[model samples]
Target chain A: MSVYPISSPPSPQAVMDTSFWSLCCYCGLEPYLWKVWARPIWVPTVVKNQIFYHAGDYPDQQAFQQAEHEGLLAIRDPQIRITQFRSGEREVLSLAQEVSATALIDDFSAHRYAGTILGLDTVGVLEFLVSLLEAEIITLAQAESAYHQLVQLRATNQGWLKWAYNQIKQRGGNP
Target chain B: MATHPQLPLTPEEVAELHRLIAWTGLEEPEALHKLVEAGLAALRLEAALHLYATAPLSTGEIAEQTGIPRGQLIRTIQERRVAPYEDPTIDQPALYRDLDERLKRRVARWKGQA
Candidate 1:
């Protein structure tokens, strides 16, 4: 007899777990509709520099640890890009050979520094979230709830969530 | 018998007189004298109400019709001192229905054309 049956009896304990259970149920019910992995491009150096500068009052130890936890730093392969510039020219002469993903950043100075100086594609998180919401992978209610949670998290971490929320709210969502 | 010679009314003066008569409903000498001073203020409100009832007009159009400064009109509308016409896209037939119902109530009380 096969250990993994085609239709197995459902476990009651599995239903109560919101995180893994929801994902499992969604996958089991709609196997064709599941998105297993997101191929998100992470610009580690850019993220690390921004976090280090902007992470106020948090100890260097804690900030470094948090950055690792948040997957802001690349663990396995450290991809470093070196660029050379000529005198009196505003642009960089050369760029890195390999770039998997671009960083989404909010800080104006960091954005300008990365975009103009390093030639990286920097997008805002709220704009990205709006696009995700519009794509229907995430419902509007879910997006709103997640945004509220993110606001609280940002307030705890960065201390300007209220201003950020107000700005984003003023720019109406896609109808 | 009239003591003074009548002067022809300009288009603006005629329109202003019509608005004043619509608002005051008075033609007596005492009322006319009172209206000559307060007529513009009363007509200004009537003009606003007409605009509000009919459709949403631009600030420039409202200013041109009522002689109220656009800034003042905007401030009044924003502060809810005067209600503006609702946008057709957002409100649809419900806005017109509500306005019509309110006008009916006011006309019933006044026993006159609204």
Candidate 2:
């Protein structure tokens, strides 16, 4: 219910959703996203719980654990209580508010809540990819490849994916 | 060796996909995106029990206030015979049988590993 403004970007510490991390892992772009955009990313305790639940089963589990061990990603509990969103989204949004960090969320409703209601500068998977493209951290070919990977994973809604592709193209990315 | 998986679509298919993307309009209605604003489903049940005990409200009234379907409220209250303080939501018994079966299998696997 609390609103924050997106005009002045928050600190570079990224509070991300589990889905975004999973998508990055699927495309082998997790490290790239962290290094280029997140800049010492953090996960909410609930997100960490999801990671653990997927640890032995998911391909990205080791990367997440390794990131935590290396201090590139830290998992902390959200100070505020929120129940309207799913476990991961709720924790990430609260943590972002608690720390005044940028929110990198992908779920549509949760994304809207953070960006529109909370006034946090929010980034989605597409925006993160576009950032990589603009920064020249990822080649156009890599971006295209990652997009296909996302499609295969169905990590995002199909309609949103199409919209995101158009956004990327508008930004002069060759995708 | 291939460094990555092959592109799933052919060039023609990819262009067709681009065309499809263009055809599809963005901006879905906000109403379609709405979810319950607050309260975990489990906590809602717990709160309903507390209210029933404290307020002496009828079961139907509690169901209406809590947004729980009336029939489900009846079953939860009568069939489960849930105590006011006991947490019935600890196990998701209302989940689909298939999911419950799978979770049981997973817990069994973990138990065996231990």
Candidate 3:
């Protein structure tokens, strides 16, 4: 028997990944809430990637520094050689040797790498969220609500929404 | 070796031996041997003792309820003595009377110091 009844499924175009960027676009608005609520208890490899991705776009210097101090900026890709180019300085710090770079951008490269070049594993996020729901810290209904809100806020991707919906159902949500 | 003469049993003696063996009532040869060896008898005695200790019945009441022959009941009681108590009226007396006595002695020693 399910603990609670499932609400209507999330909108068809709710993108889970895009929600992070939406929050990033409005970084100074209220970064603390996402940091507290959304961030998993023990930072997984994927969550660490998301944190680094969010931190890379912050306009404020303090916010960027806060992210670094909180160990959000330490996660790195295994494949890439990250080098920091200091303005007007000949000494280029090889970030791979010093510590793994959280965010790396090359002008010539087609893709900007923030977080591990390995890409964020959404499975970990899904598992973490499902655990949170099972623990009753967040309800299945609340997750569905959040998903719909994210979709309305221009989050797009049917696959992510369906995946999340299935996860909730698997955890014994009555549809 | 010296040849020994075999003495014949009287009919009464043979009948008495048969009667004593017949009390076992076990059909199987193995069961009869076990009964003669007092294995099942010992287990039954232990179970009876446990019931006597835990059951809400006096020794006399248990003897009456079980219908164990009075002589056997007296012998069993003698073999398995009831735990000592300050007063016999108390129900389910503690298993360790000696330990309670030791504790009382320790308390007395401490009280003397104080």
Candidate 4:
């Protein structure tokens, strides 16, 4: 718990969805994200519910609990029309769209919706990991470990993810 | 420098075997044995990847379906590099770079650092 940031970045505040939070926490990057992103990432209140109730990642739950007094995970409702997506995804897109901030999402459908439908800047957990590496927030070994855990957590067969992993492995964690 | 074990066969079965041998003009069964072995390996590889690609099953589940051991399946996957994550977004690193300026603005902020 006594992790010191290798460096800091101006991480433009982004609206986060539940899966993104859960995945980051699941892969041991939650506190690092909290320490590195500088700006408090926004999340809908329902996203809070999703994290506390639905998320199976204990680290994510614990991270949220520890972050309570820090005000890094800002909770707000993006009051909007509901869609076929879950409240968390809908609200993240809504909030990001309303404020024109990037949406931090990892679910494939929600990720696509953020970029293609909402026309907002979107970043997935992988890109965020790369950003952390580029900013010197985490070392390459940490990135490699985090990514391997992420790939296992996702349990996906998508090849591009492998390609991206290879790309990151090929590059140094330099900004 | 090889040995041939005698196969238990009835006269009719032997006749049928000879007929097939004559039909194919084959002297030994080594080729058929190897072909079947190679086919099974191909089937297993295909089944494993197909099971992985079609569902979100863990490597254990895929191994269960394909009858491959979990560790073996993982070793094979790592060696071959299959079933990557589903998104193609990482192809564009420039898009991710645009936001770096915003994130790189401040120095390390976590407390209790050396």
Candidate 5:
């Protein structure tokens, strides 16, 4: 296990919300998303507290811990404290701003903050799956299956699901 | 240093996103973008409060409707003191009807704002 360098030159990073990470695991997209993330996936301290420490015995906890331990996931503390949102979401939004990175937020409310207030590019979990599909990293069936799995977990909304399905079909993928 | 590729959303995806945005009853793109800026917890608490005061639904039912977890709903109910169990003497049907009217007015105002 290695530590990700905090002082490394700014790279294309994605500050993830705890829910997004958990949803990825629930949708069985962990391995593919991990491979696709080539760069460091920043995980704010508050998110670690919420997803790993507080969410007791979740199946994804071990994998997330391992990813962090292996330097694939970088655990960071936001220098600027944001009091407007909940801890994990606040830290994620703050870190995304601090690094000028894309906010990988799955929660609707949190995504709004990133998109409207912070004026940052926001990507949802479904969008990530779509990206993977577009990059040929995953098949359309895999993306659709992941969407269904996420639906079962109640981690996604109907509107986004339909949008993703339509997007997949338009991209010449069989959704 | 590694760079991440952008998520490949086609023109059709963007159109679909706009359609979904309109479904939220907001015509302006900016207004739709502003929809969920308020925290989910706050929205849930507001919804919970409305349901607690008006609806004959249980805490579990409220949680289901609001997408809040049952455990969190129980804790919120206890902390907020807004459950039926806390005050069993209210006229449920009358309260429901009253709140229904109030909520309609609020929604109309929100739509106007949008």
Candidate 6:
């Protein structure tokens, strides 16, 4: 594919990439996401086709179907095709640019590019959980439970996640 | 004429170089330069992989430190088993802060909408 410039500073629309969406499903945060945010979340069409359709092992397909039925989740095609990173990530960035969206990312490499290279605003799983805690929407215990599940799923025992866990505890006013 | 850089070749290497010169018509300097370039490229790739797997260099840092282009570097990491390492000095703290700010904005926006 011919290389084209794909640059979009995140502005308004909210789109989640495959990895972030998968993380939500695996971490049992799908219901919380749709419940807390009063907006439609989009996934790139490629992600819907590639991962979601074939995600037979995911436990929350029915919930996803319900969200789609309620118009809380949807799929979209990237009008601009940016040839960088993996194809799915390229699509996510492109779709984010196409809609001026805040791109949600979980893959570390793609997350790096999305911030430093693409300059798109992004949200990680830890941030989302922390946001829920800060909003008084979910208790600190719920956030900790979700974080534990995330650690088990990704095997990513990173210090930064612990940092985020501390941020959640500190912000939630728990000693 | 400019004197080309030289490598002290053994007797067997000289004979092999003569055979290669006869077949490929590449002078000794050009052949050695090309081989050295290939070796350096391989060395860079190995070092990049090692730094990636062990240290906490960001993808941008890896590309900047090594001379690999971003697209090619992304493809190489994608094809390999390299895991992502967050730079504690530069990216990790910044990443945590960025998350905090962005999600705060999101939460505030949600509140306004509510």
Query: Residue B28 CA error for candidate 1 (Å)?
Result: 80
TM-score of each: 0.27, 0.54, 0.25, 0.56, 0.56, 0.61
Chain A superposition TM-score, candidate 6:
0.80
Give the per-residue lDDT digits (tens) of candidate 4, residues A1-175. 4342424544456788766776677677776665544456787886777566533546667777666546676887775644635456667788887777778776555665566677777767776776667656678888888888767654333442544475575675321
Q: What is the lDDT for A27 in model 4?
A: 71
A best-first ranking of the candidates according to their DockQ comes to 6, 4, 5, 2, 1, 3
Error of 4 at A28 (Å): 1.6
What DockQ does each prediction reach against the true complex? Answer: 0.01, 0.02, 0.00, 0.06, 0.02, 0.08
lDDT value for model 1: 0.35
Best-first order by TM-score: 6, 5, 4, 2, 1, 3
lDDT of 2 by residue, A30-148 (tens): 76644433335888776766556522555667777777776667877787766556466777888888888778776555665676688776666765665556555578778888877
lDDT of 4 by residue, B57-99 (tens): 4443455555655434443454354553344444445433433
Best by DockQ: 6
CAPRI-style docking class of model 1 based on DockQ: incorrect
lDDT of 2 at A134: 54
**By descending lDDT, how would the candidates be arranged?**
6, 5, 4, 2, 1, 3
The weakest ten consecutive residues by lDDT in model 2 chain B span B26-35
Candidate 6 residue pairs in backbone clash: none
On a 0 to 1 TM-score scale, where does candidate 5 land against the true structure? 0.56
RMSD of 4: 13.4
Q: What stretches of model 1 exceed 4 Å from their correct place?
A: A1-97, A153-175, B1-114
Candidate 6 C-alpha error for residue B17, in Å: 29
Off by over 4 Å in 5: A1-11, A34-38, A53-56, A171-175, B1-114
- State in Å the error of residue B85, model 5: 25
lDDT of 3 by residue, A1-175 (tens): 3212223321111112212322332322223223223221122233233334333443333443454465332332233333322110001112222332111111111011222242311121322343345445466676555544433432222233345456567766642
Best by TM-score: 6
**lDDT tens string, model 1, A137-159?**
45655556556644432311121
Off by over 4 Å in 6: A1-12, A36-39, A53-57, A155-159, A172-175, B1-84, B87-91
